[model samples]
Target: MSGWKEIILLEEKGISVDEFVSGFETPNKLILLEGCLDKWPTLKKLDRDYLVEVCGDNRFAVGPAQMTLTDYFVYSDQAQEERPLYLFDPKFANKRPDYRWIIIGPAGSGSSFHIDPNSTLAWNAVVKGSKKWVLFPPDVVPPGVYLSSNGAEVACPVSITEWFMNFYESTKTWKKKPIECVCKAGEVIFVPNGWWHLVINLEDSIAIRQNFVNRRNL
Candidate 1:
């Protein structure tokens, strides 16, 4: 561990666009910016009642199961069962053109450890609820994780809960901790190229996520 695996906070007020650009140039550092989306209207109207009134009728696949936004809200509102419903849809670019800007899902859901596709840098902005992010540097292979042929998927799939149950506690004894943060509403987390990360919704969360590539990381 060169330094503590912590994110650098860049406050939004008076922060120039060039400074934002410069921050991305340091590919090894994770950056968190607060108050960047304070004026975004979409962030304000993402609550359950609003989403149900707006998108309740539409049916979409939440993992292997299909359910409407109204049904999903009802399911998420109750206590979680042994197997939580995970709404990991990576095809918003194709299926839902109108809702392509952000990916929305309920609480008790999350993604396993994986890097963003195509060697791209990613920025995730939380709109409604909070998400807990567990990140490892690009060079550090997380414990209990094995890579596949192309190295995108893990050799054996593990849930965020399973990883926490089996591996998270063990990492505390290591020389460095994973880059961990709880991103609340109106904040953005910058994930650099090749970093492995697991993002879990700590609450019923709405987030807009995008990926980008630049000369330095390309």
Candidate 2:
């Protein structure tokens, strides 16, 4: 990757809210905050068994179909597809109002390029395993991605793995190369509104992601 660059990383304790606001407002860049969720109970308690015990019976959207957590786990364990089904439930906030999602997926499972809806900023925190992220700025549409005239819909490669195989290298020669990083457990990645991003799990993973509107982005 010729122009490859890493997103800025900061220790959570070292940056004040005011400082973060200032930097975030001026540059509006993606940032990786380390130890941001160290004190969250989910970091220590969230796992497949815990999730199954609490929400096992609740069905979640997995690709084109819905399945319970217990069933999804069984499917994921043996899934050998190029793009495995990922558990992404939008209605999770109804059960736990504080968060928007409890994402779970096996290795090689992930989302394709797309922007967050409603132009909201988001933060994704990995609780178990790790994820690799590739992001392009709002002005740059990622390679192999197509958007409708009204931007209401997106068309991209069939799978994350396919995109990487066919398009990832092209980004390297781009003047505005994508920001890339591997976010591990206990770390958080702040995605600015309108950034085009794709995420792939490095291994069987569990994560919490929330989208929000703040004064700067609202």
Candidate 3:
């Protein structure tokens, strides 16, 4: 199964759930889970002024992000923002029922290609702008790994671009084949664990994403 790839390439057919579960590997598929978030209305929960007050506050990150929603709000770091946060156990501490959160901001806001702690499997669903995603294999992790900006303050540090992942190899020798794409509103992507990836909100986009523990991993 080898060929030239595109951003919105439909997933390979016949990828049975059992097969996907057993041999789902990194550098695998950037699946667009159709209608995954179709039930959730767009812009319904998104309010500009209300969110602006929460995001633009001087005490907060000076921008909008999941972390911003955590501090200085009804959200408690110990408590899950997702309804019935206790519905599911935490990935490590106590899987929270809600692994998903919204990302709404102007252009130029995106994330880097680094593995989340503990190799958690995750996904990104777009509700507004396009998202560019670049991924790398575990074997290709750069040697000079260090704090690119700072440790994850939940989401701020994660906001950094994939400079760390891209700062390797001579340009003349190896050009990185970033499997890039834009997840337009109404699309979702399942990002398997340990799959290094980076994303940029193409425009003033909004999306809700989450992580899940592979049934096999358990």
Candidate 4:
């Protein structure tokens, strides 16, 4: 599609923090680093039982929906035939006392197109399963994507499935391509400020993500 660019991927090796700041200055190009967060113990094993044991009754935010870990497990069991609700809990930060962690259930759970708040750059570390991310640059809006008046939400009338069905055809003749990536377990994705992104879980996915601004970007 138009307004999309191929995201760059780098293996975790001798790359330094300065190198990242220098390479990703455009705020449009996405950088994927594999094995970046493999050292985190939390990523070693992530499942319903593990989360419930670790989180207990902690509540998670799933866009407009909210539920506790205990309650979510019960809901998932009864709603096996339906799409699992995408749950992103900031409370997970309590474990590491660091950034927030967002949890999404089996295939079909994910977020729609939207921009991050405060123009902050972000990084998402996928601990388990896989996620498909479609990202558009700040200035280039994808075809058929509508925004709210204040630009905080996706105001389109169609559902994400319907948007996907017709998005390609709508942008077939465009010049820019939306940067896209399939982030797998043990990988981290760096998203620049102002990019519009939509993430769909390809399986039961567990991830820790945070947005921040430093002297480099400020």
Model 3 CA RMSD to the hidden true structure, in angstroms: 9.4
Provide the TM-score for each candidate, comma-separated. 0.84, 0.92, 0.56, 0.84
Better model by lDDT: candidate 2 vs candidate 3:
2
Per-residue lDDT of 10-77 in model 1, one digit per residue for the tens? 67885787776775545446888888998887778767688678778877567687778778767777
Model with the higher TM-score, candidate 2 or 3: 2
Candidate 2 regions exceeding 4 Å error are 1-6, 95-99
* Candidate 1: residue 33 Cα off by (Å): 0.9
* C-alpha RMSD for every candidate: 3.2, 2.3, 9.4, 3.3
lDDT of candidate 3 over 104-211, digit per residue (tens): 445555655567556677767676657666565444543334433554432323223335334533322445444445567767777767656666565656566667
TM-score of 1: 0.84
Q: What's model 3's TM-score?
A: 0.56
Off by over 4 Å in 4: 1-6, 25-28, 77-84, 94-99, 148-154
- Write model 2 residue lDDT over 103-200, tens digit each, in one string: 89999999999998887888899999999999999999998999899989899956898888889888889988888888899999988899999999
Candidates' C-alpha lDDT: 0.74, 0.86, 0.49, 0.73
For model 1, what is the alpha-carbon lDDT of residue 5?
41
Give the TM-score (vs. native) of candidate 4.
Answer: 0.84
Model 1 clash tally? Answer: 0
